[model samples]
Target: MQKFPFDAIGFDLDGTLLDTFRDLGAAVNHALVLGGFAEVSVETSKDLIGGGAKIMLARAVDAQGGLPADEFKQLYKAMLTYYSAHNAIHTVPYPGVREALVDLANKGVRMAVVTNKFEGFARDVLSQLDLIGAFETVIGGDSMGKGEDGQFLAKPHPAPVIAAREATGNGHMAFIGDSTYDVRAARGAGVPVVAAAYGYCDMPPHELGADVVIDSFPELIPALEAIGSAS
Candidate 1:
């Protein structure tokens, strides 16, 4: 068997490791109703994902003629509250995720989660799904604290990804995710990344700019190996 190249692997949470749009959509709808905006379909919530929970709600609100900043803040808070309480209602690991994680673990590869979601929420969801034990670390958007812009140094910034690598104590790290944020972050961190095409990608899988793309979790190992060989 060809050995996987990276010593540590980092994964994105929402849309990558877990199918969370249903719960996310419900939370968004809860806020929208509170804000007096028409509810969007649960399936439509997938399109609103990519950035994080705040961005998800913001997009949904913006689509409905947007609330004032202060009002939007209130609505966002409400959404977070609802989500925090119900984040794992319909969230689940994509097929083969458990098997792949086991395979990676058996190979002695370190694992971590570097997600744009807030730390508490990510931990909560993973814990509820019984997947939290698979990773050595979980770096959320808030994990790196806010930058000068008062925004999280999350995905696309490389900070959280770098933090994940440092936490894993491995220099040879590969990241896997399903969005531009993940791709850009990995690029910024100077690490190879693989795209999870079956997840809720913000763009077409081919356009994600990943070193390799896998249609499902079962393909992850081979995709990582391919990227390693190319490097």
Candidate 2:
């Protein structure tokens, strides 16, 4: 039951706030078929997703007989386009997530979404779900533009978390997410993190560098209250 002083909370979109793997897996397998590769199991696709679009597509291609660089590049582009259009087809907010978020907002806790998903697609999904209004800021994988030398820094980098903090006008913040990448990003940003064990996680929650592991979104209230009391 670790506690911290924080007035804002940042969330990961896909696996953290929403269960979007069904449409994501469908798009991936559809792209694989169009690219002349065998379809992958949804379970395997789930394991490949939290990283990002390119990483997920690359892993899928590698699983179905690796493709040449040029072919992979084309396929990856197609996959992104296809996924963007189909992102919210069957996606749904994770259990208790909507209620929890609304409750937190009502309590005046600033919230934002920081995701490795593309900015446009992330926004689209949130908009379709009517959740766009819930976040004060939404930072996607491509939002900050390429780095100093044209390199992109996605999750596992502090940029997104720092950007979220800046966007929400909060110096004291906590990150809530589902995977190791989220943990790493929060750590790099020097913020405490809460891991959602109910979401998609490639590894055990305890090993993901979270200060607390919450089994349900509703647990968040108690956790935040404890932190407030401690502070």
Candidate 3:
């Protein structure tokens, strides 16, 4: 067979490679109850995932009359604590993810994960799932360090995506994700992007402006092949 299209691939963790809504939702509820707030339906976690844990809890709390800043800070901390231990309980690879990943590796494609989750948590969860070994590197939302604005240099910034590409050997690359954050980051990094429509997309798949849209993880290699052919 002819060589594959790209030299490397970068992936987004939650909602893209893994179905983490249930575990993430549980963590959010754990914090909500501690703050004396009503627990949100776990399914609601799908809508709040792309932004990361702090934002996930913030949205859930804000929906119920909101909370004082200091109180909310404490609750966010609580959520993190709870998530650290329970993140992998219900989290698992999406359908065909394993086979696709192995196929890519067999094709000599380097792989890395660029996620909005904190570094430690991302590593821990991936480790628990035994999936960490598949990636050349894992770049978390906090991995790039804070910028002058006192915020993490993460997705929507392109820094992490750029870093992932560089880490994976800096050749032709493509990014796969389910959210606008992923699309924007991949575009900013000047690579073709494939949107994962089956994941918890923050917007309609086509509207996300990816170079291609695929309905499931199994479709990835063909999508990348198409991207390669066009490029």
Candidate 4:
């Protein structure tokens, strides 16, 4: 097993801790049909996710012949509502996620979730999966408040990573995720990342540039221990 160096760990929710594309794709397709757009396939929708809601809506709209900006905005709003209502309807934690989280928590390692999902939806998903209590903090794409200023800084940006650090009061951190966007975000945050080869990815894991890649969630234990030892 590969090992990493850090004191705390941050995770991307969707493809990292759970496989939530089914519910997200379903809601997106429903919204598209309601918006007078052609329905998209679940597989295609998977490609559209990981960037956040606005980007996902934009891609869905573009797939069905780009709608007028106002129409797109309206559709996006509706989509958000529908998605929030249906967020975890079909979501499930990835294999070994529960065990990995349990083990990490027992070890007294700080953990947080930094996802591009909406705060409400993300919380609902975690609750449904019975994993809400495992994390110290959960920051979604829409978690922007007074200090955050409502900016959507999805993966590939360090804002969410930094936010997680601020929330946990931990400077030495690592990110665990499954996409190039996650890798970029970790890099921008000046943190190392562990890529999950089993999660949803449109491209090869090698292209993501993660500091380490693991095939199973259990493999992260050694890495976490290495981090703890290094710290």
Q: Considering every candidate listed, which one attains the maximal TM-score?
A: 3
Q: TM-scores of all models?
A: 0.98, 0.93, 0.98, 0.88
Tally clashing residue pairs in candidate 4.
0
Q: What local lDDT does model 1 show for residue 3? A: 68
The ten-residue window of minimal lDDT in model 2 covers 1-10
Best by lDDT: 3
lDDT of 4: 0.80
Candidate 3 lDDT over 1-231, as tens digits, reads 789999999999999999999999999999999999988889877987886888888899998999989999999999999998898999999999999999999999999999999989999999998899999999999999999999999998899999999999999999999999999999999988999999989999999999999998999999999889888
The reply for model 4, stretches above 4 Å from the true place, is: 1-5, 145-150, 224-231
Q: Write the per-residue lDDT of candidate 2 for residues 1-231, one digit (tens) a residue.
A: 333356689999878898988888988888899998888887667788787888888888887679899988888888888887788889999888889888778767789999999889999999999999999999999987788877567888889999999988866898989998899999999888889888888798888878888888889777766655665
Model 4 per-residue lDDT tens digits across residues 1-231: 443345578999887899888888888888798888888889767788767778887888886679888988888888888887888778889888899888777656688998888778888889987899988889887675424655566667788888898777766788899887888888998887888887876478767787677887888877655645655
lDDT values for all models:
0.92, 0.85, 0.93, 0.80
**Candidate 2 deviant stretches above 4 angstroms:** 1-5, 227-231
The order of the candidates by TM-score, greatest first, is 3, 1, 2, 4
**Candidate 1 stretches greater than 4 Å from native:** none
Off by over 4 Å in 3: none
| lDDT assessment of candidate 1 | 0.92
Summing lDDT over every window of 10 consecutive residues in candidate 1, give the lowest-scoring window: 222-231
lDDT of 1 by residue, 155-227 (tens): 8999999999999995699999999999999999998999999988999999999999999989999888887
Error of 4 at 207 (Å): 0.9
